[model samples]
Target chain A: MKIVLCVKQVPDTSDIKWTENNTIQREGLESIINPYDVYAFESALRLKNKYKNVNISALTMGPKQAEGMLRKLIAIGVDDAVLLSDKKFAGADTFATAKTIAAAIKSKLSDFDLIVCGQFAIDGDTAQTGPSIANFLDIPQVTYVKEVVGYEDGYLTVIRELDSGFEKVRVKLPALICVLQGEFEPVRARINGIIHSQQVEIPVYGIDDIGLSVEDAGLKGSPTYVNKAYRAPQKETECVFVESCEELAECIKKCGGICE
Target chain B: MSKGILVYSEITSDDYLHTVVFELANKAVELSKKMEDAPVMALVLTKPDLINEYKEAFQKSGFDKVFYVVDERFGTYRTDLFAKAAVQAVKQIDPEIMLVGATCQGRDLAPRISTALGTGLTADCTGLDILENGKFAATRPTFGGQLMATILCKKYPQMASVRPKVFKPSEVDVTRDTVFIKMSVDLDDYVPQIEVLEFTKKLVCDLNDLDSAKIIVAGGKGMKNAEGFALLKKLADKLGGCVGASRVAVEMGLAPQAVQIGQTGKTVSPKLYIACGISGALQHTIGMNSAEKIIAINTDKNAPIFDICDYGIVGDAFEIIPKLLEL
Candidate 1:
C-alpha cells in the first residue's frame, strides 16, 4: 500500500503578534507542523504497522525553508518527503494551492493509492485544499474523517464525524481523506531517525518542475483576491462596568433584557 | 448577465431543513437588495418527496425561485453526486453569487462544486456583501482568527460559505411568489466511491447541538472546576439555553468536548452568549463574537473578553451567575 500524507507548517497562532499594517509578523515566528497533519502522520504510521510493504510519503507546499519541516517528517518515520515550493506559488488561494499539489502528486508520486490531508490549516483555516485537490485529481474524497479503522480487500474503512453523529464508511483505494485532530500523543523522532533524515536528500519541486505555468500556479491562478484585511470591529457597547452581582443583574434586566 | 444570488438548502440528519438555510436566505435578500434587488434563489437536492415538505420554507424566506433536483441518491449525501447536481444547477441558473451555510455538509460539498465549476470559493465567511461595482465580497477570519480578510472572486458565479448563526434571520418573513423549478440531473458514469456501513448518533447530542441554541452560557479557565460548570449549567437552564465551555475549561474536565467552543471547536452565534470567567483569547472570542449580545463576567477587568463583549462585569462567576439565576 502506498500513501501520500499532505502536511503544512503553520505558525503558532497563539503566540502570533500583528504588524501595524494588520498583517502577521512572520519574522522570528515559531512554526510547527499543523496539529491535524501530525494526526494524519500517526494514522499513516499505524497503517504501516498493520500491513506489510506499506510506504508513506509526506508532501507539503510552502516556502523553500519548508524543506526543514519535510526533513522533520522524514525524521518522524515518513519513508520519503516532497516539498512543492516556489515564489510563484505565493498568495495562492485554495484553488491554486490544490492545483500545485495535485500536479506534484501526479508528476512525483504517480500511482499513489491514497492521499491524506489535515482537515484545516491554522493560518488559512479554509479546509478546502484537501477536497479541491481530490477534485483536481479526479478522485473521491471524504472530509471530516476521524480516523482510519482498517483496510481490507482494497477498501479502507474510516469513521467520519458529522455535526450530529458519526458515520462509518468504506472507501475504495485511490481516494483522499481529510483527517481531524485525534486524541493521541504524536511519536517523537529518535536520535538515529533524526541523523538519517539529515543525511537523506529531499527533492524540491517548483512550479516549472511540476509542468505548471507561472500564471497558473499562484495568485495569478487564483480566482479570489483579498480586497482588504482589517481588525474585526470591536463591539462598542460602552461596557457598563458593574461592581457587584446585584448591579450586573440590574444591567441585564435593563439592557440584556433577554433574561427572564 | 449573472442575475441571482443562490443559496443551498440542506435537509439535516434530523430530517428537517437546517435553520441556517433561512439565515442565508435572509442575508441573500439583503445582499440582493443592494445589487439592485436581484432575484434571491435556492437549490435543494433531496429525496423525491422532500421538496414538497420544504416549499413553504422557501416561499416564506424571500426566495424568488427554488431550483430542486429530486433523486434517490440524495437520500445520503455523497459529495460527487451532490456537486455534480449543484454544478449543473449553477451552470443553468448562472447566478452572480452562490452562498452556502458553512455546516459540516456545506463545508464538505461547496468546495467540490466550486472546484468542478473552476471558480473561487471563500470558505467559512463571517461577512458577505456586494461591492459598488456589483462584485461579491466575502470576509473571513484567517490566521487562527487572529486577523480578518475580506475577499473578492474574479470568476463568474462567485462563491462563499458562511457559518450558521453568523447572520440572524429577519424576524418578519417576506413571502414571495416562489417559482418551484424541478430540475433533472444526468448521473451517468458517476459511481459512489464509498460504502456506508452505519451512522451512530452520539448520545450526547443535546449538549453538542449549540448550532440552533438561541442562548449559550459558557465558562472558561476561571470556572475552576466541575462545580463552576454546574453553576453555568444552572444559569443556562434558567435562561432556556445550552452550556458551553472554553478549551481550557474542557481540558480541566469542567465540561465535555461536546460543549466546547473555539477556533478548533464549534462556531456558535446564539442570540445571547454569556461568557463567564473567560479571558477572551482570540481563539475563544472568534467562535462566539457573532452572538447578537455578549456579557462577560470575569474577576480580572483586563481580561480581553471584556473588550469585545457588549457588557462587562468585574465579578466572580460563582457570585454573579447565581444572581443572574435569581433574576
Candidate 2:
C-alpha cells in the first residue's frame, strides 16, 4: 500500500492573545502542526502498522520553517517527507493550495493509492483543500471522516460524520479521505525514532518543481479576498454571581429558562 | 434584468425542506430588497413526488422564482449529482449572490460547486451584509474565534454559507407570485464516487437538538473526560435541557460535534446557559453569547466564563452539579 498524508503548520490559536487595538499579535506565537493533521498522520501510521508493505510519506506546503513539522512526522514513522516551500506559494487559498499539492503528489508519488488530510486546518478552517485535491486529481473523496474502519482489496470503508448522525460508506482505491479529530489518538516520537529522523534528509519542492507556473500557485490563483479582519464585537451583559448551586437553580427558575 | 440572489432550498431525507433554507431565504429577501428589489430565487433538486411541496415552500418563503431539477436519482443527497445540477443552474441563472445552509451536506456540496465554478465560499458565516458598492460582505469568526474576518469573493456569483439558526426564518407570504421554472440537466455523465450505503439517525434528541434547547448545560476543557460530561448530562437532565460543549470538549472527544457550541460548531442562543467547568474562551463564547442568561460554575473565579455569565458560582462542576441536581 502506498499512502500520502497532507500536513500543515499553523499558529497554535489556543495561546493566542489580542493586541490592545484588537488585532492578533503574530510575534512570539508558536507554530505547531495543525492539530487535526496530527490525526491524519496518526491514521496513516496506524494503517501502515496494520498492513504489510505499506509505504507512507507525509507532505506539507508552507514556508521553509515547515520542514520542522515534516521532521516531526518523520520521527513518528512516516517513511519519507517533502516540503513545498517557495515565495510563489504564499497567500494561496484552498483552491490554489490544493492545486499545488495535487501537482506535487502526481509528480512525486504517482503510484499512490490514497491521500489523507485533516478535515480542516485550525488556521484557515476551510475543509476544502483535501476534497479540492481530489477534484484536481480527478479522484473520489470523503470528508468529515470520523473513523477508517476497514481496508481490503483496494476499497476502504469509513464512518463519516453527519449533522444528523453517521454514515457508513465504502470508497474505492486512489481516493482521498479527510479525517476529523475523533477517537484516533496521535502518538509521540520515541527516542530512537527521533534519532533516526535527525539523520534523514528532507526534500524541498518549489513551484517549478511541482510543474506549476507562478500564476497558478499563490495569491494570484486565489479567488477570495479578505477585505478586513477585526475582533468580534462583544455583547453587553451585566453578570451577577450566585454563591451556591441552590441560588443558581433559583436564578435559572427566575429567568423562565427551565421549560416544563 | 440583472441576476437575482439565489438560495438553495436543501431537502432532507424525509422529504421536507430544511428550516435553514427558509432562514437563508429570509435573508435573501432582505438582501434582494436592498438590490432594488431584484428577485429572490430558490434552487431545489429532488424527486417529482415532492416538487410541488418544495415549490410551495419557495413561494411561501417569499422567493420570486424557483428553479428546480426533478429526477428520481435526486432522491438522496449526492454531492456529485447535486453540485452538478447546482453549478448548471448557477451558470444558467447567473445570480449575484448564492446562499446555502452550512449543514453537513451543504458544507460538502458548496465547496465542490464553488471550486468547479472558480468562486470563493465563505463558510459558517454569522453575518452577511450588502456593501454600499453592492458586493456581499460576509462576516465569520476565524482562528478559533480570535478574530472576525469580513470576506468578499473577487469573483462573480459571490458564494457564502450560513450556519443553521444564525438568522430567523421569515414569515410566509402566501400571496406572492413565485415563478417555478423546471431546469433540465442530464445526469448520465455523473458517476458517484461515494455511495451512501446506510444512515443511522441517532434518535436521542438531546444528542442533536442543542440549538433549539431553551436551557443548555455546556462543559469545556476542564470537564477532563467522559465521566465529567456524564455529570453535565445529569444536570442537563434535571433542568430539562440539553448538554452543550465547547470546541475543546469536542476536540477532546468528551462530546460530539453535534452538541458542540462554538465557532466551528453550532451557534446557539439558549434561554439559559450553564457553563460547567468551561474556561470561557472567545471561541466558545462566540456561539453562546446570545443566550438570555448565563451561569458559570468553575473552581477558578478568574476563569473568563465568570465574566460573561449572569450568575457565577465558583466551585467544582462535579460538586456543584450534584447539588444542583438535588435542588
The list of candidate 1 runs beyond 4 A from truth reads: A238-260, B221-235, B247-258, B297-300, B310-327
Candidate 1, pairs of clashing residues: none
Residue-wise C-alpha lDDT for candidate 1, range A1-260, written one tens digit per residue: 99999999889887887788766788989989887798788888889989999989989988888889888888878888888889999999999999999999999998899899988887788889999999999888988887789998889999988878889988988999998766656689988879979998888888889999988879999999999988666555556677777776666555444565
TM-score of 1: 0.92
- The superposed Cα distance between candidate 2 and the true structure at residue A114, in angstroms, equals 1.3
Q: With candidate 1 superimposed using the best TM-score fit, by how many Å does residue B311's alpha carbon deviate from the native?
A: 5.0
lDDT of each: 0.85, 0.84
Residues B1-327, candidate 1: write the lDDT tens digits.
Answer: 469899988888776888899999999999988988899999998899777889998899899999999888788877878887888877888888999988889989988889888899998888888888878899998777777899999997899998877788879969999999998878887887878889988776354468778878899999998889889888877677889989778756677655778776778978788899999988788898878888889999898898888778888889878777776
**Interface RMSD for each of the candidates:** 2.9, 1.8
lDDT of 2 by residue, B1-327 (tens): 247898988888778899899899889888887899989988888898889776666778888998888998888876667877888878888888889998887878887777778778888888999999988899988887878999888887888989888898875563369999999986779877677878888787546488678888899988899899998888777778889998888878898877878766778888888898899888789889888888888899898877788888888888877777776
DockQ of 1: 0.61
Measured by lDDT, the strongest candidate is 1
